[model samples]
Target: DVRTTFKRMAMNDEETVALTAGGHTVGKCHGNGDASILGPKPEEADVEEQGFGWKNTQGKGHSEDTVSSGLEGAWSSKPDRWNHTYFHLLLNHEWESVKSPAGAWQWEPINMKEEDKPLDAHIPGVRRNPIMTDADMALKMDPEYRKISERFHNDPEYFGEVFARAWFKLTHRDLGPKSRYLGPDVPKEDLIWQDPLPTVDYTLSEVEIEDLKKKLLNSGLSQTELINTAWDSARTFRGSDYRGGANGARIRLAPQKDWVGNEPERLQKVLAKLEEIQQGLDKKVSIADLIVLGGSAAIEKAAENAGVKIKVPFSPGRGDATDEMTDAESFNDLEPIHDGFRNWVKKDYVVKPEELLLDRTQLMGLTAPEMTVLMGGMRVLGTNHGGAKHGVFTDKVGALTNDFFVNLTDMSYDWKPASDSHYNIVERKTGETKWTATRVDLVFGSNSILRSYAEVYAQDDNKEKFVKDFVKAWVKVMDADRFDVKK
Candidate 1:
């Protein structure tokens, strides 16, 4: 039978997907001989041939008890290892659909050479791996599935916990009862929220949060501007910041706090908000964590309160920085010389696009999808500051969405920067052409790898995917260096 249990529970595409994707982490498919005209079967092909192998499991020899689900090939870097690599691989790369030897639909890497394939951990007797099936592809296409999968993709530890919980529930359904295995139940009253406790609270006060919103809006900065300013602060750290206790929010130290690239005003606003909050409550939370959370959380909250349809997730566990680590020299190397948008204003083309991208990729330590989402977000919100006109969100003013990438890449409305010094990407046709694609923004379309993702977000059917991707990226940037983050 099919995954009747999974479908019956109305499990979202992600949970079902994680299971299948994770399940395939260690198995191989049973491919038919070259029966159809599609291509050679796995055994018929050369040892290093790179492509996907698929088959239909509904035929004569197939049995209901075999859990093939019509997919086969390596799902893991080492097809025999059980890990989160499958989710990472799918999220990080573009896959093309193809017909298998058995005339089944499946997805495989397009034009991938042997050396170009991702390296899996070496296993004792394993040979090779191939691709995902159409059902497997749904995990990436379905908004909910893709979003959930990012949890696993971003943090393998978290994935393991979620999978363990899910697997336990799925396999233990028939076992007994409300209290038997979980533990003796505590009093129900233990779950109630305590009210009006002493204000030893460290988090931002409601008034500070509200007032910061006013400043960010009044300052005329876009969402990307605010988020990028905040994200950029923590984006640096040559791996040393996380080792000793020295890392926290040292960005708040005097010289470090005042450094030119800190965009001092951005964090100043965050600090002002925190200071405003400190006057009222004795906060237990550090100024560092608040700054990180303030970017995405505060912005989204203002939008939500005002009735804009944007939602972002936030968590607080960041520790504060000591003044000793905040030397002027300590903050020097943190400013980025280039990113997916520009090397510097008017300097995007100074270096080859790939070289510029490589510099950014290494600097931010972002995966391909993460980088794409960040680029789209920054471009859309006009957050790049130097090139304010080069984003789709610039025209909309303050709604957070993927229309920036869509508008930049859309074929229907021709988007071009204004000829004047305004730096705006204008629409030749109707709806208020206030956007512009800067050198960096243009690369998302020009670069082969970047364009695939840009095109995906541009499609009408993929709007949800775009939203989830942006939110995920926002969270990643905010959480990148926060110590004590949960798995």
Candidate 2:
């Protein structure tokens, strides 16, 4: 029956022609190893009778040498014959064990007739069966089995858990065999083993812990709930075999905000003091001396007052007086004294001390005594004098003592020659020192020292105080045993 169905479905017009030429036909009946041709016959006779017999013969003689040789040769002649034989073989093995009521060889029908008795009742070896066995039913009904099966078969989330659990067991071989079995108390959701318990020896203060809890609560987390959940998670991870105990727990404090504002203010104050000191000496001292003694406190005050920044150069003392003066030129020239005053003002004043000598012969353009007077005044005034040695009045008074004036009127009324001389006087006002020896000779007669003294003393109201202090200090030197006033 299978072969007849297959052949009808597989047959083509060209295949039919080949089968006819090879001495096979749609209706012909042939024995094993026999070839005979016949014409088309009635549909029922060709299909129901001849086709059915052909399928039966092919199924029973599939391994016979004679049947195999004949079929191969016929199949080559008609290509459809090979397909028909293959289909028949497939159907034959499926139906061979089927039985009939009479115990006769017969093909099983697709559908049973209404008059036919139930096949199981008539067939002695036939029996009805359930879909699954008792053992299979019991396993399916078991809660554990159902849970595992459902986990793998239905829920992808549960399937991932199972896979992870199995993967962990396989990889961590050191955990021992007892770790594999899932205990009754074990949560179905937490099937995988986690990383080992962290060796946490760090601790936090109770206040810090409470503050952390408050922060978490402020961030929309329930403090107690989160702690309970965390504890459960930690316990689940550690499990019953954990031996490290509560000593292994750790708590971390939150990071504090950094406070770096105004950290440099202390150093800034020191620098300000140094700048104040520096600015104060700008004009009074050489740039080299200013730098050497410019302390931090002085600089800081100067910088604050001037509203400007000041910095000391790395090299302070590598230049000549000219270089030092040039560097300090920008500062205000308000200082009362400076180291280089004489050299700085020499071009504007007298240069040589000997220029003060009085000789009538050398006085061509000017009187010789007048030249001496001008030089003597300059010496007293400290003009063009360098250092502390050049500006002393004792030396000038000693030099002028040679020309003594002896009054003929009264010996007591006689004055010293240097005191009578117009050149032996000095005048200082403001920040400049001037020698008035020449001016005194021209404006006030050299013979009248009273008029010059009266004019200067009237101009400077404090002149008497200056004279007293100067005389008091000078008398100490003049009164020394080494000096003779008469000389």
Please give the CA lDDT of all the candidate structures: 0.54, 0.26
- The list of candidate 2 runs beyond 4 A from truth reads 1-455, 458-487
Q: Output the number of the lDDT-best candidate.
A: 1
lDDT of 2 by residue, 1-487 (tens): 3223313323322222222222221111112332222223345346646543333233333322123212121111122332222112111222222322223222332432222212122224432210111222222344544444333334534444444444443344223123233559533432112212222223334453333323333433222222222111111111222211111111010010010111123223322432354365323222222222222112222223323343312111211122211212211111111112121121223433122222111321223333333232223333332222232233332221111111111123211223322232323233222222322232223335533432342233433332333222222211211111222
Model 2 scores worst on lDDT over the 10 consecutive residues at 250-259
Error of 2 at 143 (Å): 99
RMSD to native for every prediction? 18.3, 51.6
Query: Candidate 2 vs. truth: CA RMSD?
Result: 51.6
Predicted structure 1, TM vs. truth: 0.48
Write candidate 1's Cα lDDT for 1-487 as tens digits.
1244465533334457556766766655544333443335666765565544433233443332122334435555655457556776677778987655445566777654454343433333334436777666777777777787777778777777666655654554323121223555422321101100111234555565555445544444445545655655566533322211112666666555665445677667656755555454444455555455556764574345334556566665455545442333323444454554422332435565446666656555567877777676555455564444544454454555566667667665554545422245555566565545545566677688889888887787765666667777767666654334563
Residue 343 of model 1, lDDT score: 25
